[model samples]
Target: MTLPRLFAIAILSLTPGLTAHAGGKKGENSGISFHLQGDPSDNPKMIFEQNTAGKQVVYRRNPDFMTKDVAAFNSFPSQDGQGFGVVLQLKPSAKNRLAALTSANIDRWMLAMVNGRKVDAVIIDKQVEDGYLVIWKGIGQAEIDAFDTQVPRIGEKKPRR
Candidate 1:
């Protein structure tokens, strides 16, 4: 199978109630993907993917290593669906939904400038190449920062065993 096809499969495998937007066509199954990037010996990683239906899929394949339980604190939509100067990918009322739902582990974070001042912040830890993938969503800045801090840095060399 092609790489994109396999990548989609791997993502689908973790998302329980979520479905890929890719057209359901032939040769769409049986593909391999590296859910998380790391040596698996040090600085292990976690993976989470979701669909529009709020069905979250998760996976952890740290070879010969242990992982901490992924704690979810929030998943509410941004206020006004337009925080940080960008529209939220979720629905307008989704932010309220996140605020209402107690099961969702999500949080609200802020993008700030260096004002030489201490302000509320949120740090989402994950291998963020383009968009926030794994380490899906946390509730507040502290939660996001705490969880994100656990993610390994990109291209960071692993420690010797």
Candidate 2:
């Protein structure tokens, strides 16, 4: 299969109750989703062909990761001053999702989404013993802020937009 199709399959498999909008309904709300993409050891490339609003875009996926338990989001200044970072805290019930990952998946990219819009992607460099995930790459402060504002609370349904 082509890369995009395979990528879609991988994403679909990871996120339950979520469907890709590439050809489906124009605006399906896929609240807070994650997927792994490509080999962790390969060079990463930005997905220019999927651009929108003239902004460069990249696709990410995590084939083995899945969850619907994002408890909260907060932003903090990057230590080196390059930019800001967003931290995702998973609920207690969802902590196992992080534990499921192993060193074999280290360096793999974790694709994050809010309401079906690709928000951010982070490379998995180590096992997450704690439920706190610091996403410091593949997104800017603006995107992080938007995510904080747009994401629905746990057990809340996303409104149609």
Q: Tell me the tens digit of each residue's lDDT in model 1 across 1-161.
A: 99999999898898845654446532232211122222224433342232213433332332111112122122344454422111122223433433333123233222221111111233323222222212222234443344334432233333111
TM-score of each: 0.17, 0.46
Q: Which candidate comes out best when scored by TM-score?
A: 2
Which parts of model 1 are misplaced by more than 4 Å? 1-138, 157-161
Which regions of candidate 2 are displaced past 4 Å?
A: 1-31, 38-67, 78-84, 102-104, 114-119, 137-161
Residue 125 lDDT (model 2):
81
What TM-score does candidate 2 reach?
Answer: 0.46
lDDT of 1: 0.29
